[model samples]
Target chain A: MSLVKTIKELKEEIKRMSYGKDISIGFVPTMGYLHEGHISLIKKAKLENDIVVVSVFVNPTQFGPNEDFESYPRDIERDYNLSISGGADIVFNPNVDEMYPDGASTFVNVKGDITNKLCGKSRPTHFEGVTTVVSKLFNIVKPTNAYFGQKDAQQVAVIQKMVRDLFFDINIVSCPIVREEDGLAMSSRNVYLNEEERNQALILSKSLFKARDMFLDGERDANVLRKFIIDNINTKELANIDYVDIVDAKTLENVETINSKAIIALAVKFGKTRLIDNIYLEV
Target chain B: MSLVKTIKELKEEIKRMSYGKDISIGFVPTMGYLHEGHISLIKKAKLENDIVVVSVFVNPTQFGPNEDFESYPRDIERDYNLSISGGADIVFNPNVDEMYPDGASTFVNVKGDITNKLCGKSRPTHFEGVTTVVSKLFNIVKPTNAYFGQKDAQQVAVIQKMVRDLFFDINIVSCPIVREEDGLAMSSRNVYLNEEERNQALILSKSLFKARDMFLDGERDANVLRKFIIDNINTKELANIDYVDIVDAKTLENVETINSKAIIALAVKFGKTRLIDNIYLEV
Candidate 1:
């Protein structure tokens, strides 16, 4: 296992590893501070591919003006230990300069419906940033299969759309969301929550799980499920609802009557720490 | 020497060809009419790489509403023969539907100063389309080295910027502009010119060459060179000038006085056919 920093070095290592062999590479792209969610992806990658590469880049472009870009967590030593234990062959942790040099003006933008809803409503520039950095990483690490977490359900959809649209010859394997034992979805930003806020954050997953139960118990109307989740989240005095949308799983378009696969996704803020969670409703 | 139409087939062929060996693939992306410029690119690719893949795609997104996308000349048979003679291993000519399937909305855009000037002023969405399709092609082909012509100087600059910005890892080899014996730059659209229009189109290259000679003879003022080319093109009664400006070669920003390397690029119309030409001024 090797932890590389520069693009040149990473490429050299990859070339050395796959010199004469037709090796399959599984890439897990993350923002470092690896948790169970990322480790699960790495473990799955290790199982499937001959080599597994995990990219730990906290892309600055994804954060908004008031967003916690500065306050975003970083613990490379711990991340390295976690990645090694999780079976990551390569941990690529490049600095801001290495990834984005001066005058880097090119952007990969996914316009229209799929990108305009959900997290994109308030964070306009987020997906563009994600797609651009992902493109750069994809080019650098030409993996056979790339792993993503279903915790960011919309991100997976957006990335899947980008891969299909742009003809990226790699399978996007979306791993299930890893959560805490108390039903709170795991997030790096969860560190920002105080003890009380951490307890309040449970409302996100708790509401979604309850809504899932309602959905499974024959609740067909989209508005009813949305109201249940929204009202449930609103009950916690500290939690402020950003959006509670029940949309078609594939297209991310709002579903009126859930006859097919749909995702009940939402975002809420506990103090300054914003958290997101979702549950799929399939018939 | 096979002409593959589908992406799956092409990928399979490429995999078979480079199954266990470290072989370089050179890509020449063209719109197919089999001109000298394209042949030059293929010839260069053949010289440098073990496998050469030529893609003949008449990208619709690059052409604007009033542009000549529908009337664009295409002869796949001639293109195949040309590719064969040029030592191309495979000719990839996927249809528009194959390249851009349903719900393809992602676009790679190189924003700001570089793309805004030159041809971008008249055709706003032109560079976005070019970048998007090229990115898709790059993803599909995954060529070690991609060849381009310097005739579209701005395009070469834009693509180079995109590659660097996005970390595309493929070397963009810019071949010199191949011109007719009479010095008119060779283009697929040259076929669109009527006999009379063809005769008048020479003024573009003639003026550019004259400006080059003047620059070589110590003319530094950009406005003087601009006026000379504009005035020279105006001498032809049928020629309508679109733009005549001298700018830095790499940045594409207008150069007031040519101190270092610069490009005197211009666009003009003969009847319904619009033409472009440029000459590099290097100290």
Candidate 2:
């Protein structure tokens, strides 16, 4: 795969690809610590498209002031190898300056209602930042179809809302989440944890799966399910509960009872690291 | 020329045009009443592109609560004929509901500095709304080049900033303003004026020209030039000045003395009809 670090170069690359034929382009956008989840997305894209272009931009606008913006992991060589193995034709890796210049000020904000429910409740500006960066990426890439992992579920919902509202002519395919054998959701931030904290982080997905099992055993009360997951996480000494709630799968409003499509999502802090996990509960 | 009122139809129309070939598409976005200014933009688009598409929608978001949104002049038949005569291949005239459907919550906003200096001061949130609508139009039309008249000078600056900030891969062309024989800048809103109001409106362009003449005669002080234009407009019994200023041509910031490039822009009301005009000065 060819590695391009500038917007001009990537655009020229796209122009060269579009020369003689109508080639279907597929894109996967990520912040550059490649994992199995991102690799799976790239593999799916490679399967579906004639030309696969992946962008690795650690978009600063998406991170909060106190978040792990500085400490987020970055290994370009590893990411490049994984992308090429997963079948990316062009790998676009732009720096902060190229993505956001000195006077850059435009932002794309998807409204407050749906965003303010899940992770957005804690990170108020997170989804807005995500939507803005994704909008910029979408415009830059102009892919026929874009691939996104379902690990960031709220992100998928927010992007769907943005695409529909803005009428972007690109299909957004939310691929299934890739998880560890112990049920922990795979994340680039997983690198931040030590052995003990990493083991304790498994409580996140463990509690989620426990909640899922309780629902399958005919538990209907959302409060009961929410309490059960919180209690399980509380048993672990290192796990500090951030939020536990059962919300509608699409609209993300807090549900009192599991009458329709719902998801049980939770976030917890282990030392300085924050981890999130969720499971869809459908009857 | 085909007149499409629905987004689906227009998109399908665009899809048909993109079949097996790479053809340049030029877009001209406008509020319904087509004046010679709009005609000039369309003509430019036709000259520069393989497909010239013009959209006539008086986007409500751009107007202030007190602005004449409902009274904005519109004639579908007149606009359609004018678009065809001006060499347009497609005329997209979507209704208010069609453009902004139910649950449309996303917005594109460009930040303050440059947008805040000129018209943005009087009409806060105006440039943000313009940028949102223009961004949407750019995505929908997928133009190789988009045309805008220099009549709305601040608008061109705002759009340029948005395109740069958002990384939209489309070229923006700012066409020269079309004018009447007596030097009144051509606008769809000009139809709202009575004969007396129309005659009085010419003072806007006349003062701008006088300021231009002063600059040619070695006048460098911005305050002196501003006062000269304001005084000229005040001489008209029916003219009511809204704003009069001399600003840097590129930044739109108020300049004390014009050393390089500058533009004298003003907005005035004559019997409830507002008119704006400007002249670019290079010394």
Candidate 3:
């Protein structure tokens, strides 16, 4: 497996690959601290295309002023090894200067209620950064298909909306969320939690499961389902609920009664770490 | 010359050509009523790229309710012939439905002060539409370079900003505006004017030329230059002045005095037809 570090080199490599007969490129984009969740996306890309390229760059634009951009974990050597083991054809690791040069002024906003709700409420500029960087990577990789994990549900939705809206010719394949044995969703931020905070973070997924149970048992009231999850999180001594709401799955708007598809999403603060989890429920 | 009226056929044909080639595609996006101005853009694209694709879409989202979207003239056959004549490799003429299918709920917005001044004021949604459709076209064509005419100065600026902010890897090439012998800037909306209004429309460009003359004669006061242009437009018997102002060339903010690079722009109403023109000056 080859490791590429510069955008020019990557573009040149991708350009050379495009000349090879019948070569299909697949891409998986992520920030450096790779895990099973990222591996799942890479694996899916590997299965689907003739060549798979994984990009690991900690994008600065996606994090808000108060967000954990500085503390975001990085293990480039380990990530490179894992990407090669997962059958990635190439790993693109661009430095900050390459991805974002001086006087970079453009931004891509996916506009609408979905971007204004959920995680958007706190991290206002998050989706814009994701869309902008992904667009850049798409051009550099020139992939036939790109893989994204469903762990960041809103990010996936926002990207899907952007691709469709912008008429992107590349296919966006979404992989299911990868989780630990105890049902905690795997995230790069998971590394930030201390032992006690990590244990308290489990409640996020548990609350999502509890909401799923309520839906499975034919409870359709969105308010009641949200309250159940919120109350459960409140019971945890270390957990502080940021937001708990049941919204339309597609539009991401708060729904009074769940009639069709709804997503129960929540973000909680465990000590100083912020964790988010959600469950999609269809009635 | 072959014609492609559907996106699927265009995509299929592009895919076939792109299968084993490192071809650099150049895109020229337009609202088709092909004229010398649009042909100039297409010609420039042909000179720069290995594969040149031209899309003729009269995007509806960019037009305001009081604007002339419904009455916008279109002649697809003429446009197709002209595109082929202009050396475009592929002419994508998608219908409204093909570009925007039912239940489409996505939009790309290029934000900041660049979108808050000049043409952005009268046509609030204009830049948004341009950014969205151009973004869509960029994705669809996956071009190595995209061409725009400087006739739409603010639009070229907005798109340049969008490309930078979004991290699109394609080069943005700005071609000179194609003008008539009398120096009236070419535009599709020129078709809406009657002979009398057409004669009066020349004043729009004349005013900008007047400002240029002032700059050449060593007049550097932006407010004075702007007032001179507005006064010139006001003197035209059939023309109603909309806005005449001098602004910073890059940011499009009003300038008190012209120091380095500045743009003098105006919009004038000749009966029902609205005409716009601009001139960039460096002191």
Q: Which candidate gets the maximum TM-score versus the true structure?
A: 1
- Tens digits of lDDT, candidate 3, A138-238: 86777889999876778888887777777876888878778899989988888778998888788888878878987899888888888888888888899
| lDDT agreement with native, every candidate | 0.92, 0.87, 0.83
Judged by lDDT, which candidate is best? 1
Off by over 4 Å in 2: none
Model 1: per-residue Cα lDDT at residue A72? 91
Cα deviation at B47, candidate 3, in Å, is 4.9
lDDT of 1 by residue, A1-283 (tens): 8989999999888878887577999999999878899999999999999999999989999999989888899999889889989998888999999988998999999988899999999899999999999999999999999999998999999999999999998999998899999999988888889999998889888888888998889999999989988888888899998899999998999999998889998988899888888888889
* lDDT, candidate 3, B1-283, per-residue tens: 4568777788777877777567888888999998899999888888888777889889998999888888999998899889988999888988878777765656666676788677888889888888877887787777888888887878988888777756677799888778899988889998888998888788778878878998999999988888888777888798888788888877777888788788887788899988888888977
Select the stronger candidate by lDDT from 2 and 3.
2
Models ranked on TM-score: 1, 2, 3
DockQ in order:
0.92, 0.80, 0.50
Candidate 1, superposed: residue stretches over 4 Å from native? none
In model 1, residue pairs whose N, Cα or C atoms come closer than 3 Å (at least 3 residues apart or on different chains), thus clashing, are none
Q: How many Å off is the CA of B74 in candidate 3?
A: 2.7
What DockQ does predicted model 1 obtain? 0.92
Better candidate number, 1 or 3, judged by TM-score: 1
